[model samples]
Target: MGIAGRQNGVTGGMILHRTVVLVGMMGCGKSAVGRSLAARLGVQLLDSDAEIERAANATISEIFARDGEPFFRDREAEVIARLLSGPPCILSTGGGAFLAERNRQAIHDKGVAVWLDASVDLLWERVKHKDTRPLLRTDNPRKTLEEIFATRVPVYQLADLRAETLPEYSIEETTDRVIEVLLTRPDVLEKT
Candidate 1:
């Protein structure tokens, strides 16, 4: 169906009470947009990575350094599952979380998954020199980011809805666009 038709159908009240999950690369503004969207929708905003860090009682980099990526991902999935069991809320997942089939299934079953799309240049511009991202600590951060983007874009595309975010767009605009899209997907609005 066309975007307009889908929007009309969803807003017609067939479904409600489902959560919204934002999945994208690290620099794609999921956290920023999710926070705004959640505030506007009157729901809590949960960042999966942050939760994982809390659960681990350490920073993400510390977790990565101490346990490695596989271990971190396992913790991330567990945290995500726990978060999904709560009331409807806006969730912002780490860039690599949705790349795992189990994690993807968990999110798909619990909420509306929206992929925040942005170009590599835009992503680099946003993330460059950001020391917080554990994965970006390499000799060639740009090359690392590029490789990550190439590998994960397809996985991100599996989201139920795709919202393109421009480099110039403000967080409010991105959040609004996401809300507009979410208000359009009946399947997304459906309660589990």
Candidate 2:
């Protein structure tokens, strides 16, 4: 029993009828919430970033330093497209994944993108202690993060649906919110 059991007018385990692609800035809990969402749905969570790392045998920061952002982004697009063509599951993408029209088009074609909305303050708080963020290695990370947020929010707004991530909520609570939002689109999620 999961979302299907909890949602009104529904019965049985959750049936994820289409791929749910989680898109948002780094540290917004896409991976964390995807884990919970997948568990509730009885499916696997595929993280595009992890998939890329596995394929390349290198961490994202390593790839960024070796092949640069452009090459890494190209690989990201390929991985996203390939994953979306697979079975229905939860897919968590990188912070910048949805910025590309090609990736956006691929997601629109085979899956639905769910933007995990978190405020700049929340994102900064979550990421400040993590040195793994290559994009934030600038002279001033907070300022850089704010700049990136400003540039990407408009593109993220194009997601098919959005679920908020608040500082007051636990990962499970956030996952539930995502489930509630997904429940609104029967084509993407349902009870079977």
Candidate 3:
């Protein structure tokens, strides 16, 4: 579904007090858009993957290869929990984080979840050259992305809000769109 249609469910004048959590596939501009959005909103920004990497003393790729995906997911959940336990802020979660029900519930209970929706073509165009993604290290990166996109799109749809991250737009524009969503649908930002 398109972003405008996705936003129809959020209406009425409700205030939002929780953090804004960005959830989507890799290369959907969560980190960049989130940082800009947080700055514009005058809130702090935290990247869960970066936090996990810092805590593990290694890159996400290294962590995955060394400890395995299960271990990495466990650590990711822990880091996300820790980050969410703190004050309201903008959090950019790992692409696969929201695939887990525990993490999804945590985000739902703790913040306003915004799914940065992007088409498979857009995602591929943005991420095809990035070697930092462990999941993309396959013989065919396009196929890998397509697989992940198919699986994760439905999962991301469960988010409280949805915003399109067009390649033509700047990060500031994406952030502005998110800000507009938050301001228009404050109910999604309510603390639980």
Each candidate structure's TM-score, on Cα atoms with residue i matched to residue i, is 0.84, 0.89, 0.84
Give stretches of model 2 more than 4 Å off: 1-12
Candidate 2, residue 90: how far the Cα is off, in Å:
0.7
Top lDDT: which candidate number? 2
Q: What tens digits encode model 3's per-residue C-alpha lDDT throughout 1-192? A: 333422322223322367789989988998888777665554678899899999889999889889999999999999988888886778888788999999999888887789898899988988887797878999998998999888889989999888888878889888778877776665544212
Sort by TM-score, best first.
Answer: 2, 1, 3
Kindly list the per-residue Cα lDDT of model 2 for residues 1-192, writing each as its tens digit.
Answer: 455443332334556778999999988998899888887777778889899999999999889999999999999999999999887888998888899999999999899999999999999999999998888999999999999999999999999999999999999999989999998998998856
Each candidate: how many clashes? Answer: 0, 0, 0
User: Over the full model, what C-alpha lDDT does candidate 2 score relative to the true structure?
Assistant: 0.89
Write the residue-wise lDDT of candidate 1 on 1-192 in tens digits.
Answer: 344433332333333367778988988998889878766665678888888877789988889899998899888899888888887778888777888999889888887689999999999999996898768899999999999999999999999899999987999999878877876875555422
lDDT of 3 at 49: 86
The TM-score of predicted model 3 comes to 0.84
Comparison by TM-score, 2 against 3, better one: 2
Task: Give the TM-score comparing model 1 with the true structure, all chains together.
Answer: 0.84
**Model 1 C-alpha lDDT versus the unseen true structure:** 0.81
lDDT of each: 0.81, 0.89, 0.80
Q: Model 1: which ten-residue window has the lowest total lDDT?
A: 6-15
